[model samples]
Target: MLRRKQHRFQHNREAHNVIERGKELYTTIKGHWQEYFKNDNPLVLELACGKGEYTVGLAENRPDVNLIGVDIKGDRIARGSKRCIEKGLTNAAFLRTSIQYMDEFFEEGSVDEIWLIHPDPQPRDKEEKRRLTNPHFLTEYKKYLKPGGLFILKTDSPFLYEYTLEKLKEFDGYEILDHTNDLYQSPLLKDHFGIETHYEKLWVDKGYTINYIKCRVQ
Candidate 1:
């Protein structure tokens, strides 16, 4: 496992679709991705994009938009980046970086939409600050999202679903577009909600209900 990880890290650095940390350009500007992808398409991000199923899948369907999969795991990034190349997906890229430093790579108001698909819920009360849908993370996201940008959260954790719903209520500049504790049972059968991650499928097979929330950051 260790050897495979090391090899993947090295291989990812050479993949055009993969961007690793310590890249000088990443430290400087946020909108550099436009130049990288060589287009003016709206940017969409899949946070904690393990193996980039959402990023690659969305890019395949939405060629009009550019997609970036952000995750810290180089091994998973290698798989996603490799698939992007094999499929000739120019609009899809993988960024091997922690979500905590997203602001450093994106310009203010640059992002058009964000998909937090099956992110770590940080279920413990003491880890509330680490929850991706919590205030701290939401504040960071708001800084880079354009006005009226959408945030889509999909999870199997009931705690996170309820917690995020309450947080949205207290947040001043955002409004809940829609939410459902049982995604499969909801009327939404397509688009972002229809796109499933590996973890999502596993949860579904285990008889866990998937919860989803869509909010517009004003």
Candidate 2:
């Protein structure tokens, strides 16, 4: 494990698509996002992007929108960044950082949308604050999202699905766009449901149903 991690770290150092600690402009990437992509297109964030399946897939299909896959693991970032360069994808990049500090990297109202794809459910009652759909994380996400921007979540945890719905009811600044306990059984929205993460596939193969929630931040 140590050797593999070291190898990934070295590769990340040489990757232009991968940005990690010690990068000069890592903290101030928010206002300069368009300049980084060399375009004024809308920005989309994929939080907790492991292997960056959704990030790479979305960027490939939607060249008009820039996608940044955010995760703390150097190994995961290396995998995604390498794929982006190999595929010649200009619209996708990977950021190695804790999701708790997203506001430091993106300016308020800078992001057009956010994808909380298959994030940790934090199933225990004591860990509720750490859940991505918790009120605290929702507030952090809203800081970067544009007015009326979409906050989309896809998960396989029933606890998380119910928790998110309850939190959304308590928060007055957001309105539910749509939600489903079983994504495959309901009418599918192609754009949001098309990209599947590695963990998502594993859960589905084990007969677990996926849940999704879409809300607009006011």
Candidate 3:
């Protein structure tokens, strides 16, 4: 029993490494994270990356970019990171942390591009602060996105999409390239969903409209 407990304890530690690293990895990598990877790859971030579905898919398709999946849930992080490891992908990384503390991890104008896929809309009035497209979070993203870095947001919520569109007009650091109700009808929707994760495929099956946008951060 003691040996079993010890093994379980070790297991939990490995599972929580993303969370632990999320808290402290940035301070050490402030100006030198790229050195550790030893290559000139574009830094791509998937914010609120549940299960890292998109991150893993993107890394699989594009070997030229370094993909980082960020989420706050341990279970999701474990599943996502484990999948990446199973695929033997060196270009992908996962971090467990809240969006509120993102500035700590990314230096100003460091990220080359960003992806926000299926982020919780938090429709409740009180939870409006939790919306990933809230002006505050946009500001945080702007700080990390390099000049002209691409910011892509894909969701099923029309409310969130319309809200984001209105805000982008007033926001300082973005140029909205495409805003659409159905991604399939648009010629720009290149099957970016690699493994389909779980939700993206489900949404497609249910006939939910998938909205997408590609914004260039100014």
Full-model lDDT, candidate 1: 0.86
Q: What digit string (tens of lDDT, one per residue) describes model 1 on residues 165-215?
A: 999899887889999999898886475635787878888999989998998
What order do you get sorting by TM-score, best first? 2, 1, 3
Q: What is the lDDT of residue 22 in candidate 2?
A: 80
Per-model TM values vs. the true structure: 0.94, 0.95, 0.88
Give each prediction's root-mean-square deviation over alpha carbons.
Answer: 1.5, 1.4, 3.6
Q: What residue pairs clash in candidate 2, if any at all?
A: none
In model 3, where is the ten-residue run with the lowest total lDDT? 15-24
Candidate 3 clash pair list: none
Q: Assess the local accuracy of residue 76 in candidate 1 as a C-alpha lDDT between 0 and 100.
A: 93
Instruction: Tell me the number of clashing residue pairs for each predicted model.
Output: 0, 0, 0
Q: State the TM-score for model 2.
A: 0.95
Candidate 3: lDDT of 130? 82
TM-score: the better of candidates 1 and 3: 1
